[model samples]
Target: MAERDTTGAEGAGTEAPPDRKRMRSAARLGAVQALYQMEMTGATLKGAEVEFESRWLGAEIEGEQYHAADVKFFRRLLRAAVDRQAEIDQLTDAALVERWPLGRIDPTLRALFRAAGAELLALPTPPKVAINEFVEVAKAFFDAGKEARFVNGVLDHVARAAKPAAFPA
Candidate 1:
């Protein structure tokens, strides 16, 4: 797994346990995967949330163990993404280059944007923190550094727009 922490405690020298940091990161990634599954399978929010919460949050599969996620944060992300999808999509579209509308992007990327957008829009989490968390999530899903950079750029745009004061002039 990636060595980065999404809980903003990296390099802090014991501000929080590594396991706690990893859990939040896992929540962000889980939210993205749940969102993608919902889109691809037309799963209802409740159904998908239940499935992820009960079966996948910390389950082992194929000899690989998934970290336990912050269940509340995961639910918040999933609900916000679905509850505010239209706005999220619009924000994502505005952030992307004109040639690459939100719909035209990879489905995984679209899910990533929506999850990040939800935090940027509705959560009190710092915009930069949210961006960094989701960028790391992108890295987990993709092998190439290119996708991570793309995630960072788009999320920066969304963050600036969603919380302008957080980014000072």
Candidate 2:
């Protein structure tokens, strides 16, 4: 369900390269933020999706442009995350330690994991791809903090569990 935009806003003139795969990556990041918003504000799934489409997509904050995301992928991530939050959370809990459960994690990181878990569970992309994308998203938020490593580990664990065939014996 990937769509291509010939608008060239993604690459512009120079500097940033064309978004061959980055659009989906952007969608993942955006979906995580949208999911976080829903979690914190108790927003409905449809409401969150609309807000993203109307206000955030292609909208700017400063001077820089926001990358055009894969809207279909975003919807998939958000919908799957919303529908399977409890199951995803249970997997996250299982991946965590006894004391430091998912609730103790930062809310944003929790949202990131939830979106990542949804993608992993949905089977659209390879688990490694989804895990790597979320890990990069973690680094973007925390700048190589412990959270990034935590995300990598937990995501790898979840991926291994959810798609065991992806991992070798």
Q: Pick the candidate with the highest lDDT.
A: 1
- Write model 1 residue lDDT over 50-169, tens digit each, in one string: 999999999997999999998887888899999999999998899888998988999999999999999889777778778888989998889999999999999998888888988877
Point out the worst 10-residue segment of candidate 1 by lDDT: 7-16
Tens-place lDDT per residue, model 2, 71-112, is: 887888899898899989999999999999999989999999
Model 2 residue 5 lDDT score? 42
Q: Scored by Cα lDDT, where does model 1 land?
A: 0.87
Q: Give each model's whole-structure lDDT.
A: 0.87, 0.83
- The true-versus-predicted C-alpha distance at residue 106 of model 1, in Å, is 0.4
Off by over 4 Å in 1: 1-17
Steric collisions counted per model: 0, 0
What's the TM-score of each model vs. the native?
0.89, 0.86
